[model samples]
Target chain A: MKNEWPLWEVFIRGQHGLSHRHFGSLHAPDAEMAIKNARDVYTRRNEGVSIWVVEAVNVSASSPEDKGAFYEPSNSKVYRHPTFFDIPDEVGSM
Target chain B: MDKDLFQYLLRLGDNTLVLGHRVSEWCGHAPVLEEDIALANTALDLIGQTQLWLGLAAEVEGAGRDADKLAMLRDIWGFRNLLLVELPNGDFGRTLMRQFLFDAWQVINLGRLMKSSDPRVAEIAAKASKEAAYHVERSADTVVGLGDGTAESHARMQAALEYLWPYVGEMFVGDDVDAALVAAGVVPDPASLREEYDAFVGRIFATATLEMPESRFTHKGGKNGAFHTEHLGHMLCSMQWLQRAYPGASW
Candidate 1:
């Protein structure tokens, strides 16, 4: 049968205080079912306390063909690294 | 041994066991990948509950049987599941329709069972209730989505509801065994759950745009082991074949 259902990307919060991370994608009739399907597919083993599902179509991703233009320039900026900053011991653990 | 308690436990366990097996049949065949996984997860939860209920039943019986034995060794005449659970999954709509009907009642029943005088029953009910609550939410949503969605889906959902409604009455029907349990404070009377079940389903049906069947006629006898639909026997044939063919077989 043709899968007319829309594809959804699933994210899961593994525990309290954790951010939901991209886990996988699945087909569902709608967002409600997408979350339910996410639970069954990715969180069956108590892997998450929260879930978020968005339609795959809604997400805007950079094309792999533009990978050099999108990411290569960022590598050339060394000041972007926080490691270059010196911190006093009084600002402990920073 | 408390015979009444044993019977009551069987009633609880068999309902999950039978329905679990039925839902598991969708493992490879559900209409969509998401739904297939959802149905399998639901089946796993029911089977997990079955272990607890039937495990307690075996202990009460004191006849050396365990949960696996009780589940796999039982014949059609020995099962105590409501007939509603054993019906074939005619289609996705029919399957979820049956699930919503059963899950609605099961969640309410499990909620009340959480207060049972028997600590073990209460503990099991508490754990199973969590899963039942989720099951009901999903099933009810699906029912509404399909029942109100389109011409074909709406028609199918209505037909599924009508086909499954007659079998639902048996869940609330009780007899001497229930009386004994009630007297001991081990559980509530089955009939008492009807009002809440009606109100719950009524609201969902309204949203789903499906009319409730006017007929109140109920099919009975599955819980008491007095009678069962022919489907149960055929189901058990496949479900019990390995155990029956090789007694005491195990991994």
Candidate 2:
């Protein structure tokens, strides 16, 4: 019976002005139950006001194994730096 | 016992005790493992609240007793909780509905209690109100979702509301204890809670696209020392077993 539903990732917003952050994942019968389960499990301390539960399968992410090859070239691009520009003493802070 | 204070504390304690037991019943039987932990967590919160309230009740009565003793030894007639908290958790829908209703009432009740003239009661209410606020929001969200979801979900949600509706009235009906608390400004009048509770629940139900049931047959008894449900006996047996079996036993 438990196998009937899929896994979901829970994201929670601690307050009205805050962004939803990843809390944890849980198995539930559906999206609705997933949200309730997330609230019950993660927000019992009054930690969240808003919640978002997405099917785990629906989220896409860059693979950890591809990290080095995917962005190593960017680290060597010193020419991209704008440090050569000069600033007036009158606008010293800028 | 100072009948007024005793009854007041008993209501608070009983509410937590019964609700805690109801939530604990889901320990190993939740629909999913994550929910098992979730239910257990809620139960723990209620148990903690019960201890604080019952402990205070013991003190006010000058009974050289403690929370555990009050919880473990009390008979049905001694409890003063609302009937709503003792009802069986029929399903996920029913449980969520029950929680939603109780949490909604608690937020208002606790918020008012936080301003109580009694410093101790106010302090406890202030702390518990924060937790109750979260419980209300979480359960309200679930209530909305289930009520607006698929056909099967809608049916279950409606059934859950129907099963639990009769007990809703008991929540705001004041007895002698409540009346005295109101006069003393230690608690707000129960009648004053209705409009706010209705607005909060109404907004959620509207957003969920669920029609509110209009039946007005209110069930009242648990607070008056009458028991009409089978859940409490089983709940007390499990909750009190260790204490009863080994009197004075401690970890």
Candidate 3:
């Protein structure tokens, strides 16, 4: 019998239209079962309204050496920070 | 509170308590990590349901025996769970088979029990039915998946069904306690649930492509407190050791 099951990445949507945030990974035979395993492992506490499971192999990640090229360029763009915005008094709490 | 209600609560609570113990036994031994957590969660739900049933049972008994005492101190003859639960966890296949059988019965049982004439029992049943629904769904999925899976898995599942099928009769054989409760509208008649249970199990078996066992002989005795398989005594020995040894040492 084969001992190793395929690996999957779990994503959970906390609310409607919310981006599914990556929680962690687990091993399952297929995508449908990955969803079931994700339910058991990640959402036992009534945490998610929806779940998406993708094969870990199918995902592509940037290299650790490319971190500076990918993210550091955005670090100097301080205008992207919400702190730069001045809200009128009428925009209460925003 | 009548002795009949107390006895009925025992039958209900004992089933949860004993099977919770059996499921908990698989804490570290499940085939996969996901299943390990799933079984533990399932066991927790049963034990929680047991607390509700046993607490009510103690109040109805009114003899000062509380839930812990009833659960931890009882001898074999005092228990009223069905024989199906007490059977040892044979394999992954057998464990799921036992779970599917009981969860199927309980989903229907609790559905009816939630509307019990006795409000406390009804409240507990309402809460338990939600959890039992998940148990039945998860277990039934596993049963069908494995039964229709690889050749080895199919064979094992078929064997498990064969071994456990005979013990299911005791679950629905209403004794005097059940008769009184049914008459009081505190519960539905056990006979009423039989067809639904059969249909549910049959539908799953059909999907699994597994054949029903030929032996139609269904064993009975657990609900009456008159008979138990050897497994129950051994289970009680380890389960009761703490309370029996310390005699009420609490954390």
Question: Per-residue alpha-carbon lDDT of model 2 for B115-172, expressed as tens digits?
Answer: 9888889998988887787678778877887899889889998888878888898877
Ranking by TM-score: 1, 3, 2
Docking class of 1: high
C-alpha lDDT (0 to 100) for residue B17 of candidate 3: 100
How do these models rank on DockQ, best leading? 1, 3, 2
lDDT of each: 0.93, 0.84, 0.91
For candidate 1, write residues B179-231 as lDDT tens digits. 99998999889999999999999999999999988788999889999999999
Residue pairs clashing in model 1 are none
Model 1: per-residue Cα lDDT over A1-94, one tens digit each: 5648888999999999989899999988889888888988999888999999999999999899999999999998988888887899899995
Please give the range of 10 consecutive residues that has the lowest summed lDDT in model 2 chain A. A1-10
User: B1-251 in candidate 3: lDDT tens per residue?
Assistant: 38999888999999999999999999999999988988999999999999999999999999998999999999999999999999999999999999999999999999999889999989999999989988998899899989999999999999999999999877777877788889899999998898898888999999999997756678878888888999999999999999999999899
Quote the true-contact fraction of every model: 0.94, 0.81, 0.38
Identify the leading candidate in terms of lDDT. 1
The CAPRI-style docking tier of model 2 reads acceptable
- Report the CA-based lDDT of candidate 2 relative to the real structure: 0.84
- Candidate 3 per-residue lDDT, tens place, A47-89, comes to 8999999999999988999998999999999988889778999
In TM-score terms, candidate 1 sits at: 0.94
Best by DockQ: 1
